[model samples]
Target: MALKAAGGHGGNVHAAARDLRRPIESLLDFSASVNPLGPSPNVLRALDEGMRLIRHYPDPDSVRLRLILASRWKLAPEQFVIANGSTELIDLIPRALGIRSALIVGPTFSEYGSALHRAGAKDRHVRAARQDGYRPPLEEVVDCFRSGRKNGRRPEAVFLCNPNSPTGQACDQNGLTRLLKEVDRFGAWMVLDETFVEYCHELSQLPSVSRYPRLIVLRSFTKFYALPGLRIGYSVSSARTAALLRQYQPPWSVNVLAQRAAEAAIRDQIHARRSRAYLRRERHRFAKALSSLPGLRLFPSRANFLLLELPKPCRAGAVAAELGRRGLLIRDCSLVPGLTPRTIRVAVRSRNDNNRLVAALAKLLR
Candidate 1:
């Protein structure tokens, strides 16, 4: 199958290589905001050992992995449902929950809109303004819920990406709690995508899943664990709610290697700590370097990527395309609703790669 771009989600190195007629390794991919440190050393060892299990079918229930997750979050095993990736869970949510309409908090991931559309559901957006640094407007969302009847009826669900992509802005737990209260009062489901939360674990709402029955928290081994190739992610909700999602998932969606890799990745605390420390230092250095470019507007980011606005007359598409020609890929956010035409996003990579991108941007912007 030809790997087509999924809602402009980035990390299309294969496609970029094919288009540029260059080897994949030659590209510096700042498009996908994955861990710069790569996967845990333990995950590599686990994959080697797990190769023997490929002949046998993977655990359809993902029992051991769920048990590990349950232990980590101090939740019941029944409250978790492992999947091929968080994207699978995103597609399943609207279908499983009978969500006919949703209010998406944007500008954020396109998958939410695509997933709802695929489910034949109507959706609307409550976007964060650029002037506000793209912080999720939970207040406006609550007002919409309290006021009721947006387009003649209430939304059955609300989708929010905490530490939201492209913008890299996040909401605090208090804000989420307030929003959840409003959602529950109006009898709506809240799907919180915490894919980027491993970088800012303190902001995660995963531990609050038990308290808010209407809340569902999504996580991934792809980002922090740097196992995007493995395609393992899971969702947490009340046991009853989790059962609903599980019924929609196809059998053996997560492979044995992904399951084993996730298990090893989760247990590697030392590596996790090292990865976080590296991102803190590197993201700061990178942001500072990018800020030096004249006529550039850099948004504050808690996550491992930075969102930028190029100088006037410079479109994100043009900048991204130019950078692509130089074998440096970035996310052009111009088409993403709620962002300006000059908007672009880049991942916080290794020191040398980050510096290379900074120098390239400086030269191009000059």
Candidate 2:
């Protein structure tokens, strides 16, 4: 039987466990690039405290959580719009902004295109070449905008995932600024997905949202904060834009426990610093080990995962299937647009878990 569909995304541990006929805890999942260190202790405490709030309705505005996020980013509370997850915000964007067409920078997340299609909006793509190490092609995007303007087919918006998914390549702040300026000149909106920016803080453009009237930065507690089960995320933009997006959201879109957990997660500076330092050290060690495997090409990543290209004679689907039989879960990127059949992605997990995956892969590739 086919594995339960994750809608083309990862982190479906439940589905994988059931398909493998094993306990959920028995599987080593390196498919989703969440923090291996896990959520902050404070978050657990907050969740416990928040359990009582479930008896009442969640704050429709998520006021307390927004205030905490505002203080952390030095933006006003009105500039924030909390949602069930960053995916929810992604779905709302085209509808809220009345976007008719968008230019997507790929090979990246599939949801952007899916969300646009659901809104009956046309979408185009400018893919990054593997020869360029999959660095986000911001320059090409600007050129596309300029050329599209001449052809009278300029897109109404641009979707860019910084420290992008699967590939793990990010555009520098300078390049992002230049691209935003070009988008502004074309009178188009820029939807910047900074989902994994916590792993590389310097590249984030969240704090500068107010300066660019058309720029919307999407962030998540799911990745860095290790709160995927909570499904809490938010966007930062000008107050006017935030209001417009809020208009499209249903009442109580964010639940009580998620808001409380996210509020505590953001306030734990010690946990954040420790998590970043641990990942940096562990990722370096893990990458070195994977590099020793013959015929595997490992891509440099600023995020919490590594993308790999298998040696010839090995396909991602086959390797993933073999690993899955051993209760190891990985993302097969063969079907992701702009990627080759050899490409696969794995999360940066704990030392023991990473070592287990490396050993499994070594034996298979040999």
In order, candidate lDDTs are 0.90, 0.91
| Per-residue lDDT of 311 in model 1 | 95
- Model 1: colliding residue pairs: none
Checking candidate 2 for backbone clashes, the offending pairs are none
Per-residue lDDT value at 83 in model 2: 98
Off by over 4 Å in 1: 1-6, 149-152
- Regions of model 2 farther than 4 Å from truth: 1-7
Task: For residue 349, give model 2's deviation from the true position in Å.
Answer: 0.3
Q: What is the C-alpha lDDT profile of model 1 across 1-366, one tens digit per residue? A: 011122667887888899989999999999888999999999999999999999999999999999999999999999999999999999999999989999999998999999999999999999999889888899999988877755557889999999998789989679888998889888799999999998889888887888789999999988899988889999999999999999999999999999999999999999999999999998998898899899999999989999899999998888888888999999888888889888988999999999999999999999
- Looking at model 1, residue 292 earns an lDDT score of 88
For model 2 the TM-score comes to 0.98
